[model samples]
Target chain A: MREKTTEPLVRIRGVHKSFGSLEVLKGIDLDVDQGEVCVLLGRSGSGKSTLLRCINHLEGLNDGEIHVGGERIGYERRRDHLLPMTSRQAARQRQNIGMVFQRFNLFAHRTVLENVMEAPIYVAKRPRKEVKREALELLERVGLADKPAAYPAMLSGGQQQRVAIARALAMHPALMLFDEPTSALDPELVGEVLTVIQDLARSGMTMIVVTHEISFAREVADTAVFMDGGLVVEKGPPSEILSDPSDPRTRTFLSRVLKETA
Target chain B: MASATADPIGESSLPIRKRPKLVQWALIAVLGLVVAAGAFSVVNNENFGWPIVFEYFTSPRILSGLVRTLHLTALSMAIGIVLGVILALMHMSRNRFVQSIAWAYIWFFRGTPVFVQLLFWGSISALYPKLILGLPFGGPAWLEMSANDLITPYIAAVLGLGLNEAAYMAEIVRAGIKSVDRGQSEAATALGMPDGLTTRRVVLPQAMRVIIPPTGNQLIGMLKTSSLVAVLAYPELLYSAQLIYAVNYQTIPLLITASLWYLLITSVLSVGQYYLERHFGRSEARSSLEAR
Candidate 1:
């Protein structure tokens, strides 16, 4: 059952996104309460990742609105018009939203510690001493305390993704967005990254994860959302949705993915 | 041949292979002969006047001219690189009028030959004999000065060389910026970094890897191109050589001295360029993969 009470932390109301003439998201409406781990699942090119990007303003909305932490995202409603914020103003809103990319987009030139400490020190304008202490603590939490000084290029793909997670957490954002975080990792390496994410979920960190790792989704996701063709086909608790999905498209996708792994 | 003969040490049943590198030996022998013949011709030719080249290479006139040449190159390159960076940013501006203005400046400077441009600058007084520091056309003048007094050969050379080099450097800088991946800028922006900070800290530092080598080449080219100012009679290295050879009728030796100096400076620049490339490219600190 979907939890729809007590002020949803993320509320998407009739959000529509299109690129040129092609509609990527058509009226996506959903809600996640505080501390809810919502796993977005779908086949390739089904607009799951696009929806996640829209939440962060990496993609613009064609119509409707999204609210995160009770504030309008990407656009400001002034006198019945959805006026877009300036790039600088839009960046300020992203400070509350941490995004982990599929490729782990860690700054290749900076050491692991610097990568985590960058946004906190430079963007947030925090004092270096306090930020350094917390950043080191984050690295230790991510099991990379020894690699604080190692550059991104020196670490494995899994380790880099872990550092990216640490970097995002250093901001202490209210909500985190994971765009197929482990999809780019090697099969064996994916476990390491997924383990760290599971720990985050257990600690009640609010997250919207877009992933194809069905088992990980089942284990950690409080709610499972299956989207297809720019719309959410079905959404329910992971236990109910994974075993007995009502939508035909969702069933077909799950069967194919599960068969591949088996 | 070495790989073909090599086999696993424990697998003793493999055949002992034999290979001869006759083709490589023959090529090396021919290359050695060509080197010997070329060196013999250059050393034996008395028209080169090796003794005269050695004697005047360090002459006070030549040395002063070399100093002037280096000074002109440094000033012109600094002006070019600074203006070039600004023009590149302007070219990438979202405003069409700004982009067009930058484009027009590049077109005008690059369309004309540097030699012709230097000549034009040298003869600027003929076009406008008097320059007035004033308001718009026909307005009251704040100050008036004769163009010939203001635009000496030295000033003309600096303007000509610096302005012309700026056009090429602008294109080089733009290309370097374009070479960076779009994801880099997106990540920086998503991290809430302001545009100016992102460009300076993230974009430019990464773009430096691409920008440095071509910029080094331009520096060396500017050192050689400073010679074009000779037509303005500015007394740079080539002009000084011409002045020396004109009086003594020793054109070839003096020219050789100038060429050798240019080569030596360029060699030093290449070494510095190599180190800069290594510093940026090999920045990743080594930490071996840890045990699981």
Candidate 2:
């Protein structure tokens, strides 16, 4: 792993997202340093996933701004007015940010190799041969080299999620986002996906993960953020936040999580 | 588990309840009765001679009419499929203007009776006596065709049937497109594939699973619907049979002849539809198994 850098790779400020008067994210402010793994921990409907989606502009934010690698996402300045970027521009910006959905939203029609190679050829405009080579390497790295020709439907849930991670990585994104990647998997399958993610973290890939896997968070994440009722209650080093949290909400959450695992 | 033990010889395990053999026998008996009734009518009727039935089918006039019937069916289906695909694409477009235009086309065609459309087109000569083929404003005429000369009854019938079918096909296509998950589009976007390539490569191929079955139904419907063209005196099989029966006064036999041929063609088409549906079903089944 590379040495930690002082400059942050992503900065989110005053981010508020609402869907029809129901505010899901309220005035969020966070900074993630380059090559750092940040775990966003929250209960269901606590806005952890919503915050990750906002970073990619999958769900538009009503009030606030997101910056990736120092560039503001979603909005562009035109004639002194800041307007949301067109759908195409927003999609282009999303190319720099890779996302692995909770449900393993792999392209069902494509084989694993095709899924990994698709974005590089079409989105990044890389040569087909080059993309194929890189995609094969990624498939090998994810321990799925033998399943390149298999469709997502043929793989187990954990395998499908790994393919999804490889597909996201094939784009060479500067930052990766995982929105509860293992939540949809079978209990036994969750560990396989977590292992792949943990490997990525060890390799120094910058990642923001929203997960209920406290053990994985405590082990792999550098910073742990505890969110409750659409707001961050506590955030600090994993050892401190997971064991010595000052906020009562954080303490309650950790106790509940520990009890369930036990 | 206790309930299963209480009823050790469950209803499913009983020999008498094993299979619905009685229901199967009843269906067979019903089918036999219908076939027997049809056979009896043909055999007992004085005018219904098998020789005459064969003779009429092999007659030159009837054979020519058969050829014409086939021509009309082929032509209409060809035109219908091409126009139908276009309308389907239009209906699925995201642009408001394009979508509205498609909606208007579907509403207008589907709202009107096909019979009326046929008659209107057949009599379009009364309104536009001359067909102009030049620029709207002031360009010289490249060619000119009189409506009466160019707009034959057959041409009018084909146009009416093809255009009307396009509207229905558009709805079928829209349903097919909607069946695909929204994530498919997002995945394509994430890959940086342009909209058109994404539609052609990713979306449309998956949508075909939903599209092909309905399109098969429409093809069968078009085969029967072609009978409507007879009202315009296009000399297709039904109209030709009507002409023969009116003179010979053997209505039942002639009608039986025409129906037999229709059944034969539709049966062939049904087989084709079955095979196509099976082919697409296999791929869908494979994909679903993978998803599991």
Candidate 3:
């Protein structure tokens, strides 16, 4: 085993993102250690999703640095300055980081197995036989082995999200980000997706999840972070933050969410 | 309640009737007679030259000309589709210079009449007598040829038709690319595919569902527009007919023969376009059927 170190798997320093005049993330800092499951809890428009996007460099940072596995996300670090990497270089950097969106953005034109196998075969240049076999295994893991031939439009929202997760897993990413994975699913379908994610958490994958599921967060997260209006309101163990929160904002937010779910 | 058992729920299901339209039937009858009368008069008229049209319809000269027209259409459309895709990408590009260049190209080509463009290409030697194969701005020429020799009728026709078609095709292609959801490209980007490969493998395939129908229309339109090449005295289908009629003085018959061939090809192409649209729409078709 590699020696445990103080260095985190994902490190963000004073990250700020904005769309024109409206700032989404304002000078945020955080760290996710290796093999940790960190769940971001917040209402809509609270910068949790934007922070996750910045980690994978899906959204560029206006000011700050995000490093995953000791490498900067979308920029090269020169002496005393940071220069943006070329798109090709930035794409290569994204290979190690997997992301699942709220809408479950599976390639609608691709079959389930093809979606899982796409990045491996096309981007990584893996042989078809090898990728296909592994892709089948991934489908089996997601409990979708029987529907490899099905297009995404034929699948339920929960099934599509699972396939999306498998698609991201095909790259064997070092870190995974889930942005409201079950938020779009039907109420009855949410459990299946949460179960899949809980299994992933148990398997020691380094994941940062943004979700409104308080019970799931308390069950799976090593660190539960409450964010509000582009800033982290409170950060601590799930037990402390979920049941007996310190911050008044966190208390208010949690109460509203729990009442809605209840 | 007791009588309902025999009738099985409410008055024999109301007979499932459609209202009769007396005016529609009367209009159809009148239109049919007019069409038949017109057809009979044309068939009876000796000057119409029906037999002459049939004789030259498959004549070797006319057949070869028909082949040339097909070749020109296919080649020009090939150029148009390829260059159209490139220009569409450039027009959508974030770079101001590249985007404006594409805009300028589309504006110039679409602004001018294609007939004038063809004529310009036909006498391009008047504009530039000698053509040089080298760099711009007084650079040394590696090879030189007369413009008349370099720009043959076929080449000129292809260039004129293809370049102009590309301008329209570019707009069609742009609309297609825009129709795709933004999330599709973002998902591809998240999977680590570069923008170019993502476009080819992801965006363009989805865009084809929107791009195919108008492209088919353009193809059919090109079949007829190719007749304009006759102005250059190039012997495509129409010009070939013109050649025969000029000798035999069978103007109407030869022209009729050429029209028949154009109609035939365009009809076939329209059917083909239907099948291509269905092929691209497979997934959506299946899903809609499932929904129904």
Best by lDDT: 3
**Model 3 steric clash pairs:** none
Backbone clash total, candidate 3: 0
The fraction of reference interface contacts (C-alpha pairs within 8 A across chains A and B) present in each candidate is 0.43, 0.37, 0.58
Residue-by-residue lDDT tens digits, candidate 3, B142-217: 9999999999998999999999999999999999999999888899999899989899998999999999999999
Instruction: Encode model 2's per-residue lDDT on B98-169: one tens digit a residue.
Output: 888988999999999988988888989899898999988768888899998898988998898888988887
In candidate 2 the C-alpha lDDT for residue A230 amounts to 80
lDDT of each: 0.90, 0.86, 0.93
DockQ of the two-chain complex in candidate 2: 0.36
Off by over 4 Å in 1: A1-6, B1-34, B132-134, B140-145, B284-292
Per-residue error at B230 for model 1, in Å? 1.1
When 2 and 3 are scored with TM-score, the better candidate is: 3
Candidate 1, residues B247-285, lDDT tens digits: the string is 999999999999999999999999999998878766532
Report lDDT (Cα) of residue A71, candidate 1.
91
CAPRI-style grade of the A/B interface in model 1: acceptable
Per-candidate TM equals 0.90, 0.85, 0.96
Q: Per-residue alpha-carbon lDDT of model 3 for A29-64, expressed as tens digits?
A: 998999999999988999999999899888888998
- iRMS of each prediction in angstroms? 2.9, 2.7, 0.9
Could you say which candidate leads in TM-score?
3
lDDT of prediction 3: 0.93
